[model samples]
Target: MKVADNLAQIQENIRQSCSNVGRSETDINIIGVTKYVTINRAKEALGAGVKNLGENRMEGFLKKYDEIGNDATWHFIGSLQSRKVKEIIANVDYIHSLDRKSLAKEINKRADRPISCFVQVNVSGEESKHGLSKEEVPSFIEKMANYPNVKVVGLMTMAPFLDDEAILRGIFRELRQLRDQIQAENWDYAPCDYLSMGMSNDYQIAVEEGATHIRIGSELVGPYDE
Candidate 1:
């Protein structure tokens, strides 16, 4: 039950998934979602060779960042409040929830350098999910050019947890098409080259559909009691 064992399996899954789609396994960056686990467990993920780590909350991110420092590439993989941007802007390498202009303004104002961001899209149309609708994304990304310190590196989405593989694949494919459309624009501020989709339940399908970054939580790092 060591993290390394779990990681190996995940890696293999990624490898197989990539092969299915003619993608190189090296293209996939597995982000160990450590928000649900302790810092010690996060470190175990690092020790297991998980170079990227994701945390959802500011407090959790800061706590792990305090101990782990630059040893791991930090990803803030949750909805970020504009008020909390200053606290995490400098420490985080990637933000996977850049959905609105207000949050974008805060990140641009606070970041010393251009921060990598993935525009979150609510592809599933679920009212509970936080992201811009597909129709809103193009205009939203076009405006990102004004925020000099925020770089739109990719798009992020969360598919509904369901047993249907077809539904999961469709959601991921739509996001991938959206990413391609944005990438083709060649916007200097929004290269939009990556796809930050998938989680513990649907990463395999996400990869097959061209996910460059996958966030794994309970699978990569087991959930811990709060």
Candidate 2:
């Protein structure tokens, strides 16, 4: 499908989902997840009117960012290691996989420049994932005080793929509630605004619940290779 046509379809779906829950489509931001897709595809997306683009790997993004233009917003939506945080800190607009204090400090050590960052919370207790559990976030949030450069925009998570829609909603709902609680109790350190969840498979449902930023893979720009 043409990039424009695909973008239109996703936008229509976003509007329908938002309307379903009495939310405006304007509130939701669609980030084109371009992991494996080439820089040409990113250009196509921009040509098609996609202003936001997401890449998981810093290595790949570095090579592609200059070509994609300085206007396109770039987000690091994959598992980021402490070793590579410095290089990505200055470039990517947002780092969505921030899961720990150690990583935060590492990102902060060089984060002299302020950036939009999210604390990755593992709402599902899945060992395979990279985020900290809800119980661990408080201390992490506390630790965030040391980082003057990292802005705690909100929380993010990678939902477990399940056959049950209820199961999926439950995970997203939990993330929303947790974010609410943090903001309510810890206004000093917690900043709750962006809920970075959902992807190609589940973004529609996510928007219906309360996802301000959805990292759309697959359906947005098609499959991403390593």
Candidate 3:
């Protein structure tokens, strides 16, 4: 299908969901995830009016980044390693998967420019994933305060996918809580102002639960890989 058609559909869905829950569609940001799609497809999405694009892998995004030129702001939304940080640094506008103190420190050290970043909170406690536990957020953020180069923009989480809204809500809720807590503690939270959650299937619900930035993957690009 056409990108405009898909965008319209998703916007309509957002409007419908917001109307039901007494929220405004304008309040939420739906990032067009480009990890599964090609740069050509991403160009189509940009033409279709998408200003933000999200990618997961470093090298893949680097390839597409070189070809796409510069226009849409890119967000790095997958698990990141300290080793792979340099390649993705200048290429990304925001790093969404900064999961540990060491990783954050590493990002801080080599970062030439101030990078917008989110602390990945492992709200689901799944071993298969990488993120700081909700309990560890305070200390993590404290450690991050020492990093002048990388600015904390907010928190990100990927709830374990299943047929359970409660599970999703529980995780997203934790992210929201952490975001609020951090903000309350320091208004200078700089780059940290977003709560990135949700995907194609569960985005509406995520918005209702207070998601400022929703990482929509299949919803925008249609299905996903990894």
Which candidate ranks first by TM-score, i.e. highest? 1
**Which scores higher on TM-score, 2 or 3?**
2
Each candidate structure's count of clashing pairs: 0, 0, 2
In the range 56-158, model 3's lDDT, one tens digit per residue, is 8887779878987578888889888898888878778889898777777788777898889988888889999888888988777777767887788888888
lDDT of 2 by residue, 1-226 (tens): 7678888999999989988989988888889988778888788888899888998887788888877647798888888888898887777888888887777778878777867888899988899998999888867777777787778888998888876788889899999998887787665545767899998889888888799999877887778432
TM-score of each: 0.98, 0.95, 0.92
Q: If the candidates were sorted by their TM-score against the true structure, best first, what order would they fall in?
A: 1, 2, 3
Q: Which stretches of candidate 2 lie over 4 Å from their true place?
A: 186-189, 224-226
lDDT of predicted model 1:
0.94
lDDT of 1 at 142: 98
Candidate number of the best lDDT: 1
| lDDT-better candidate, 1 vs 3 | 1
- Where model 1 places Cα greater than 4 Å from the true spot, the runs are none
Q: Write the per-residue lDDT of candidate 1 for residues 1-226, one digit (tens) a residue.
A: 7889999999999999998889999999999999878888999999999999999999999999999999999999999999999999889999999999999999999999999999999999999999999999999999998999999999999999998999999999999999889988999999998999999999999999999999998888887722
TM-score of 3: 0.92
Two-way TM-score contest, 1 vs 2, winner:
1
Q: Which lDDT value does model 3 have at 76?
A: 88
Query: Residue 20 of candidate 2: its Cα lDDT?
Result: 90
* CA displacement after TM-score superposition, residue 59 of candidate 1 (Å): 0.4
